[model samples]
Target: MTVDPEYASALADGLTIPHYVWGKQVDPLGEIDNITYILLAKDQEEMRLRLLGSATQTMSIILVIVIFVSSTLSTAWRVFRQPRSVVNWCTFVQSSSATMAFGFGITMKLSTACNCRWAIWTASLGQAISGICASIVLVWKAYLAYDRDRRFVWAGIILNLPEPLYLYAAWMHSRTTFTPLGGCTMLYPSWLPWARFGMDGPFNVIFSAAFIVVAARQYRKHGSAVWGSLRNEGTIGLLILTFSNIFCLLLTATNFADEYSMMFWGVDWLITNQILIHQHRPMRRSLHESGRARGRNRNARRHDAETLFHPQPMSPSDKFAQWAELNLLQPKSNSPLASVLEAPEPDISDIGHTPAPNTASHLHSTQASTGYW
Candidate 1:
């Protein structure tokens, strides 16, 4: 852990880091001038931030990739089998955004004085593209939810029209520095954090509001039975996106450019993509038909229906496989496995037969029906 005198001197003279500090200790501050000691301390802090940022960003990237891969694989066959232009384009943009984020993160982590400018420009362009694409995807979902309402769609389009130019302007005013730790850091104007909030906050609000309105309409049409429909519709994923966006906004506003900041980058796109995949899963769409029927029978109290239907609820893994069957298997009509692989339709014959009192079986039945949202 011996410190190198020449390296230390060069660092104190404000030169770029020549090498990484691998378990090497800083020389005693007693032998250095006050200015050198201060510089060393500052560099130590910057190095800590750099290493932490790299680690967290790596984890974020890994998680995003896993989500993308699993979601894409699950939907790949279906996407091809039933080609919808909206979903197709959405998948493309999600892939593009994830790629840009991956590249931008790698460049930031591996940046040096030699590539500092490259990192800066990459960051500016890559991040702008990623963010704007994510926003567009979100707005498109809202537009579809609103039944392609012109006003809502046009508002979203116009609001986001300035995103590229705004980002370009912000990057122009931003300052970049090469850290003594051999990483690049960008210092943006205070308005940048709020700019991010402004860019994303409205879309999230609009999308969430539109989703809730749709849910409410379903509820009015189906009553308490709408739970199953909601579950099958990826309500949980929607809520996750809503809360995560709010949390990230809070962090960016209060602690801008801190360790927590970069970790959330591209998360919205990842989660949104997952939701889209989940919604389009074949099992979910089939479930939705029964979901409405279940809602329709909500008023006729069938307290023991759940107990009779699901004496023992399926386990999580079993439930997942059941849900995943459509993605994994397409039973050949002539094969023996066809009968085995095919799921039995739920017998809603007894759904409203008896006007029994409400009971916990209702809750159990609800959980058993959808498993989890």
Candidate 2:
């Protein structure tokens, strides 16, 4: 087999990706940037062992953080007011999967930099777990959007029901199908990796199309007749969210298809983060509004209670209050007709006679004295 020194050197020179080592599973002195170097498995198993130990440490740290975040979010949902029902659950799945992805990255996928057979096994486990969660969330999100809108045409209620089940089966396959392909991966049994890629595409198409279709229909049906801008904004946000997720999840299929030998999980990272924390902006806005609301609520009640109980004269030093009142309240006009019009017109029958239009001005003069204006 060809040595990887040129590749490692090229990469190191191009980007600053950190490196670690596992067992003899990876080429160490591969081309870091553009220059070739030694350090293949034949060079030194001792160095490989050291890299493995360090990688294991890194994986452990990431795994711990993932567990903490997942548990904390779960507990928060159970005890406190959940941010949302479906969206929150989807988020939990995404977060857990992400943690697992990171664990896998540090373990088997990046094994060249940090190789260990045990770490490889652990990484595989983490990746499988993440995949299973992703499958479930995908199915859930699709159904949630469709059912909420009550949109479908002859599609079965459990149309995408096979998603989670297929994912579980795929995870099982990964266990039985692993190989020593210089690292831990389900690329063994050859059929398994392709199978995974196969499942992801159909799964993504079903759910993504479902959501996109439903959202479009909803916008078309309601957007036209409804003059409410809030509806439009909400519908538009849903579209943005749906399309972004579709593009993100679609990568799983791409990975399976081997479009790129190198997997970039960053898109997946940002996608799940955006999805789960969909309400992040809304939550932030609510917090800001709540502060103002609390103050307003307190002021409103105080104003009411004070008027009913204290009935004190306005303080002259309260310039703000005075200025606010002046700005908020319209001032009365200093003209006679303006004052007269401000008063309620007397009932024509109360006079018991019809008045001449010429005397209308004289009748108005009496009303201003009562200060109804």
Candidate 3:
């Protein structure tokens, strides 16, 4: 075996060199075969990792694309078929952000056409957008559930604001590099996991807790009716999201790879936006309708019960006039009979009058004496 002078010098100095590069050392005997095998094995492993990453990314992208198409079509259909309403614009933003994040990521991973910087930056921006928009939608839901109380809304906004800010700062310091097998690898600081955790963990806990509390209150107030209202709002979806967030937070807290933890990222975005887009409208409408129904019932109760019942038998004048018309007189204008019939009855309630017990008899006696009846 013949060793190159530089290789001998590097080995003597205890400097480490890549096996592939070190393989270039002159070896007239068959000693280079071992280095070649090592390099080949390393290449194989790299290729396998690249292939696995590509396959997973492709699957995530396909899932997100399907969800995006369906959600877009559904939202469009709703926009056209329904009247203008309190539709949350965040729903649209959520869908777009998820699609963009996954789409850009998959595109950058699969193809080498675009600059990596652009692709990675766009994907990062999309992720930030999705997270922020999702937070907004959650706070809005809590707002609606709590009777549109601005105090909680403001508190939620304040609490959630830090996640995106920290995310932005972390992303600024983050870096990525292309692997030997044509895959991108995220290079981040040790605190990257904490950043990811902060992006979703605590705020999700608060929002999900708020929702669950509201649901409990509704169940208490309305019993089974809460099911009817929450069916439209997808209470189960909220639980799913809460659990998913908790799972993601655990993954991050345990120092799992960001890439592995992100498998559900796009799917989470889809569900978040889908809940807001389809379920929220019905929930809001149900709340508004229920409110209006209560108002109507309250107003209905204020009406005088006597007015709702049939008027007291009939006034003596009305009975007598009817009998006279049937038996003798045809109603004629400018006649005394016509004047009697046309005269407006004084409203007892307005005049503060209480009729006597013999009021009907007394009225009949007076009319008979006056020859009016």
Candidate 4:
């Protein structure tokens, strides 16, 4: 009657929980030199939850990659459109956030003893760098917005500092944990699988809170609309930042990393555009203004009609008809977006559809009909 070492060890350790136990091959020298393998039993109940978490993590990674590439390109594209402003800097901040949440978040997220120590170092450093970048750029957006509102700018103070310190601090912390493919994180020395819990967890909580607070405080007057810029652009940054922080908190709290890793990936992927695109206002506006300037207006605007019909101008009727079209189609200056709205389709009786009386017929008839052409 031989005692099994696996059960015997667990019993000796006073352990009762179930776990995955790996058994080994036993040789013929059973009595004197037996080389039997053993494994610790795993809890069956945790199987499904942990599996789901793993799937979620996979998806989260895919999304992060998408975000990284897309964001990089988006900023690049903006470079061509708005060469004057450092818009890419602001856009890159959003990109960095998406990268950190799924990239480093997952690494610290999977900080098990089995994970290589080197990975923890790199991921942690990467996140720290990303965070530093994000914070600076976020602050930059506020600065730019305020600059736009108030013409004065403090160029000297703004340009000479901050990033160097950010880069140096991130590098120093990262040296503690950097290994292949694995991201960096603090080395925790705890049994419950949350050794670096104190170091990493607290920062996320604090930063998230600060991000939301700053965004809220700065935009209090504008409510994300920023008055001059598009409404969507004003609030998109805050929304993305808020969502990232909230997800980070949730992941930490529920051990989702331990259970639904893939779900996190999905979230990371979605955020890339949400966060960065807010900075694409210049692009969006450029398109709108150009379209307006170019004759996209359905009225068939004769913007260059004066030049076209130079010396011998056409009859006043021809001019009136053309002008009528422009006046009718000219986008409302007060609201550039008013055209997108569906105007109450002109009822036959309500007027716009009524044919314009020929100018020669009667001035009163033309005026009374509210004619365009």
By lDDT, the best candidate is 3
Return the lDDT, model 1, position 210: 71
Q: Rank the candidates by TM-score, best first.
A: 3, 1, 2, 4
Give the poorly placed runs of model 3, Cα more than 4 Å off: 1-49, 79-87, 109-111, 180-182, 222-235, 253-264, 274-278, 292-373
Q: Comparing candidate 1 with candidate 3, which one achieves the higher TM-score?
A: 3
Q: Which lDDT value does model 2 have at 75? A: 35
lDDT of 1 by residue, 4-97 (tens): 5635643564554433223333222212222232234446776466455445555665666666656555555555754554555555555555
RMSD of each candidate?
21.9, 13.1, 15.0, 18.3
lDDT, candidate 4, 1-373, per-residue tens: 4544534433443434332223322211111100010111145444444344444444556656666767767776766655544546555655655555455444433533222222333444444445445444444444443333221124323432443443343334222222112222222222212322233234433433443444455445444433334334445555565556556545644555442332342353355345545544543343243222322342334545655667566899999988987766565555645656545565567556767767766876676688755
Model 2 scores a C-alpha lDDT of: 0.44
Candidate 1: residue pairs that collide: 225-295
N/CA/C clash count, model 2: 23
Candidate 1 lDDT (Cα, whole model)? 0.54
Using alpha carbons, what is the TM-score of model 3? Answer: 0.57
- TM of each candidate vs. truth: 0.53, 0.43, 0.57, 0.38
- Greater TM-score among 1 and 4 belongs to 1
Pick by lDDT: 2 or 3, better one: 3
User: Over the stretch 1-373, how does candidate 3's per-residue lDDT look in tens digits?
Assistant: 4444534433433333333212333212112211121233335676576566556655766777778867666666665654343354555666666666656655555554443445555666766776777677777767767776798778867876666665554356554433333234444466665666566767766775686676666656666474456653565766776666666556644546555543444455566666666556556555653442322343345454555774568799999988998656767777788889889987777465665659788899999999997
On TM-score, the leading prediction is 3
lDDT of 2 by residue, 5-86 (tens): 5245324434333343322323232212111111222236644653464344445446555653664376346334544444
- Candidate 1 off by > 4 Å: 1-79, 107-127, 135-139, 142-147, 178-182, 222-228, 231-238, 256-260, 266-373
Q: Candidate order by lDDT, highest to lowest?
A: 3, 1, 2, 4
